[model samples]
Target: MDLVFVFPVNLQKTKVLLSELSFFVNDEPAVIGLSENSDKLVWTGRLSPQKVLIFKIEYKGRGLDQFVYHLDPSLPVKNLRFISNIRGGSNYDYAPGVIPATAIEPHDQNNVSLTWDYKSLEAGVPVGLILPSEKSFSMLIATMTGRGWACYILFFISIVILTIHGGKKLKFYENYLISACFGFFFILLAYLAAFMNFYLAYGLSLLAVSALLYFYIRHLLASATAGYVVLILIVLFLTIPTLAVILQGYTGLIYTLEILVLLGMLLKLSTQRFFQNVMEELFGIL
Candidate 1:
């Protein structure tokens, strides 16, 4: 029988240390010649029928993104049981074609065990684990930048609706300035986040933008109008988009719900007297 164990020594960022390697047959320590080449340990030995064999190896490694137990593609496996005790991250998944764990039990804070038991498995499908990758601040900023149009469109639409509903007129240049301010939110956040914590930078950017919008809208229209605009800015620009970033997996769901909620709000507001007057003004009939 030939056996091989592959370690993450060469692939990982940190050094991997192998402390113990042993093989036994028939409850006695058998001296087996083990060959080491790069990250793989290989051994070939003869086995008699009904003779039990056991091999154990221990290693310590760090910063490895994945762990996979490779099985010989030409052979069938029977009665295989694998368990992995994980620390730190909780989110994990299997590689393509790898069978998922049969049980996952949480022992304590930051400790969990994954178990897979199979009576038989065909060749080519191995046990694999995928660790969660940490999100980079730069990546977050990039996502925010790419999705910045959502924030601007929602804010712009709210401004248009509120101004029209309140019977206020906004000059072309005034609309341009408001759009610029909304765009500046992303630019300001990208720069600030590079110097400080992301959350702190985000809060500062939000406050600065909100304050600017509040004063500018109040100057152009009224305090009540400005208040409403500021509230809309917070919800659309800061709250919804940031939440979508934090919950990256559920971004589509969050945005879908946001669109539905906004649609409901617009339908309800359209029935009001002020909005009807604006419709009449624009089309000369309502």
Candidate 2:
């Protein structure tokens, strides 16, 4: 890959500082052939106002994944362009920035040309292109499933506590099995997502698990009211929280507010003597 920076001459001795001009070739640092002073590529030159100075940097790299160019905010850039030739099944995609004046993929040759023309340019966001990867979707699913485990554990604890407080005479093994089923919902969604849309798989898995758990809870507690309560808790604490995690960026705030609201409701309910009386009657202590 090669990068060229063009500077407009202003009839004054100008020194351009170049640091962090390192590139990796085949997962190793590329050999840079430049005179450096204290790890800085110092380019000094003097030219007339009407002249332009061009600096070209060349490097050879293998297995390059992405190329990012961060414009120095202090420098004024009039125009910037990126040109590349694609090969070996490598494709490119860019983020939001100055739209490329030329089409990236040309049908005649496996090459891409992009230009950003500006009357005057100020440094803003970094512009970059991501190289193609095979495991992008798989990695995404893995991350989502890993985070979902936390939600599963939270739901399991809630269920166990609710069952115990409701005075259900269930064995330890049965409770463990119920919790396992709740955790399995996420695993099911993960595999299903590989074959279909993620949201669709998530909805289907949630409905299946919720229905199964509702009936199981009703049978275990011998009360329709207990089953409905469990269902509501699963929806509020498990389903919605999992969705928030998947959405990203809103997970922390959503979870904090959810826990606060739940705690507030618990405190309000605890103040009622009826709740204490029921607990005492069921457990016959405290």
Candidate 3:
């Protein structure tokens, strides 16, 4: 056995092995030692190497933004396993001086589990998790603003490509309308999300904007290329960037990979007659 201390930190209720103020040893009930420190509950006992010991603690508390576990820096850690179950959110981070979890498992919808298993860990490492909190709409909008420049660039490039592929240059007013339709997608999503599920909002926005672009392009170009332009715009300007925004941590890498893939596709298309003609015309102007 080992000495255990539970410090009172705004905890409303605490339990050991599902019993209030109860302790157990080797499947038998045990008494807890009284602590002189009024702020903490302390217990100590001896253990047999042959017997299995299990300690389970349940805490009902609030007011703490993050939970942390401290390990003795001077002692070597062996055969240590830590598991945490979180509900309602998956966006989390590691606290300073804490090692990342070895594995993350999805427990259920809106639940996640993090595990850290170490066979022979050196001294001085601690374990902690910075729990995710609910984000306000303003905060989410700010985050989108910070990471959305690439999406705008990609949207503009798609429009330019669509213009070239149509073999008809877009008038200034037509270009403005394209830009307005693209911007309206985000505006519609933001408003729709306030009263409905996010996925539903996103889907509605995508469909609405896609239909608008299709009809507008079809009216202007009057070609089968309208469908291709809408498809490309949806994938490059909306879907991929939306994924990158949702993943958050992998934003830069996602954007870089997306840009490379788009460039490769453009290079491949450049060998085609229509694309070659467009490129020659574009370069001939210079």
Candidate 4:
């Protein structure tokens, strides 16, 4: 599915782009879970943008995934002619006519060459969307259920590992306990937000977590409070968009992986700078 060229390239931007230009559009609701193939672009017209199509024009080493999009097509001014060459074949093999999935009428093939020299289309056009059948949909649903939730599970596990590693490093219980407890608080906040809103979930939760983190770290690290606070806030702002990316469909899983990596680094740092005397200090160094 080379996104470089589609019906949008030459057609007018109609209020109804895909359905107007293509035949056999259905009224029933469609589900768009995710697309993993390369060079693929999904189309969602009119209805809350919820239909999906994974297009593959030619076999490729890799491709791209796209969400359903609503684009208007009835706008004027463009070329309608399309042509293609067959691999290792004669010129006659290119019989141009009405292509599939397109709404345009195919020119009469029976007519002989007479008045105009308008060239025939040399390629096949898709007539309309061809989605995965019911069986495929059933299988896809199962995969989504298991795999999507699995990401959450893996995310939880990473947090646990980091907490354990961080906890083991402290020679005293007080500082170690506070840091570990705060980290746990952030993890709980993350999944807590996930249930309500998919897109905003990670971002809001991460903000809550990061603010708590940088503040605590700043209080403990040195005496420069204001500058550290400003730096901490700036980093939190920068992290918000990254968390948003994590919440995005399909690819957001990568963002979760990044979170895990960061957690690991955080844990590693905690271990290296473990506070053995912090608990004793709270007791006036005993």
TM-score of each: 0.50, 0.49, 0.51, 0.23
lDDT of 1: 0.70
Misplaced by over 4 Å in model 1 are: 1-133, 280-286
Give the root-mean-square deviation of each candidate in angstroms.
12.3, 15.3, 13.0, 17.7
* TM-score: model 2 vs. ground truth: 0.49
By TM-score, who's the top model here?
3
lDDT of 3 by residue, 95-115 (tens): 988899899998765678888
Clashes of each: 0, 0, 1, 20
lDDT per residue (tens digit) for residues 8-126 in model 2: 21222233222335543334544444343333233443555666444444433333455455667777767554444444334567655634434455544344444444555665435
Lowest lDDT 10-mer window, candidate 1? Answer: 12-21
For residues 111-157, could you state the per-residue lDDT of candidate 4 as single tens digits?
A: 11111112333432332221211122223323433343334344333
Candidate 4 has a TM-score of: 0.23
lDDT of all predictions: 0.70, 0.61, 0.71, 0.35
Please give, for residues 240-264, the per-residue lDDT of candidate 1 as tens digits.
8877986889999998898888789
